[model samples]
Target: MSSAAIFVNIFALSCLVISLIKDRAKTKQSLLVAVKSFFRILPIVLIIIIFIGLLLGFVPLDLISKTMGEQAGFGGVILIASVGAILHIPALIAFPLAASLLKGGASVAAVAAFITTLTMIGTVTLPLEIKELGKKMALLRNGVSFIFAIIIALIMGMML
Candidate 1:
């Protein structure tokens, strides 16, 4: 494991020990809730993992590169941002996907746009958002997010 992983583990363990010492009953209850939440999300998480694995395995690297590599330019960024906005994937699943895309020869800009839009925009939930936040607000939020995502991606591409 990396040093960062080791540090995080130690920190979590320390915090858990402190929680146990401060209040065993509450700590136990919290642990139960955490376990239940983990199991509740496990199925979807596994499905996403499997799907991404299959996609990466089946999709040729050359094709991925041709679509999202440095040579692909802003068009690639826009394409990935649109796809990200439309997909209803959890952000937890996106990090690994981004890494895979990078390894598959995707440009930094495209990957950045994908992550930003995946986290910021929600085309799948736009209807509900519109109902709750009003049509103008919902549209504005998504539109602004999409634009900024692209900008952020381009900046990251230049910097990285």
Candidate 2:
């Protein structure tokens, strides 16, 4: 593992120990809460892992490269962004998938756009957002997010 990861682990362990020393009951309660949250999200995590494995295993490299590679240009970035916006995958899962795509010859712009739109814009949750936040606000937020995601992708492409 990287030194940064090791340092984080050490820091977390130290914090846990300090918390336990300061308040045993509260620490126990916090651990219980953490475990419950992990279990609640476990199924989704497994599903994402399975889907990613299947995607990488079955999809042809040539096809992936053809659609998302350097040659695919701005249109490809927009296409990936739209796909990302529509898909309901969690951000944690999206990173590995994006990395895999990059390794498979996808352009940085396409990957960046995918990640940006996936996290920022939520087409799948639009109905709920509209219901809770009102139609105008929801639409405006999503529309602006979509435009900005494209701009960010273009800038990333230029810089990197």
Candidate 3:
């Protein structure tokens, strides 16, 4: 595992210990909730992993590079960003997928845009967001997020 993963695990362990000491019942309840959430999301996680594996295994590297490479330019970034916004994969899986694409010759801008839109713009949850926050607010938030995602991707491409 990466150092960051190790550090996060250690930190979480420390927090659990402290929580247990302060309130055993609450800590136990929190642990149960965490486990339940994990199980609830496990199927989707597995599906995402399998899909990513299949994508990497079956898709030609040359095709991926040709579509998402430096030559693909801003159009490629927009295309990937749109895909990211449409797909409902969890952010935890999205990062590694983005990394794999980057390794396979995808442009930094495209990968960045994909990650940004995947995390920030939730097209899958739009109906619920509109129900909860009203249509205007939901549309504004998603629209501005999409714009900002593109801007951030462009900036990252320039820097990196």
lDDT, each prediction: 0.93, 0.91, 0.92
- The top-ranked prediction according to TM-score is 3
Q: Pick the candidate with the highest lDDT.
A: 1
Rank by lDDT (best first): 1, 3, 2
Report the C-alpha lDDT of model 1 over 1-160, residue by residue, as the tens digit: 9998899999989999999999999999989998998998898888877977887899999899999999899899999999999898888888888988998899999999999999999888899999999999999999999999999999999999
Mark the 10 consecutive residues where model 3 has the least summed lDDT.
44-53
Model 3: how far is 56 from its true place, Å?
2.1
List model 2 lDDT by residue over 14-70, tens digit each.
999999999999999999998998898889888877877887788898788889988
| Model 2: worst 10 consecutive residues (lDDT sum) | 47-56
Question: After superposition, which runs of candidate 1 have C-alpha atoms over 4 Å from their true positions?
Answer: none
Better of 2 and 3 by TM-score: 3
lDDT of 3 by residue, 1-160 (tens): 9999999999999999999999999999999999998998899778877877887889988888889888899999999999999999888878878987987789999999999999999998999999999999999999999999999999999999
Could you tell me which residue pairs clash in candidate 2?
Answer: none
Q: Where does candidate 2 stray beyond 4 Å?
A: none
Superposition TM-score, candidate 2 onto the true structure: 0.85
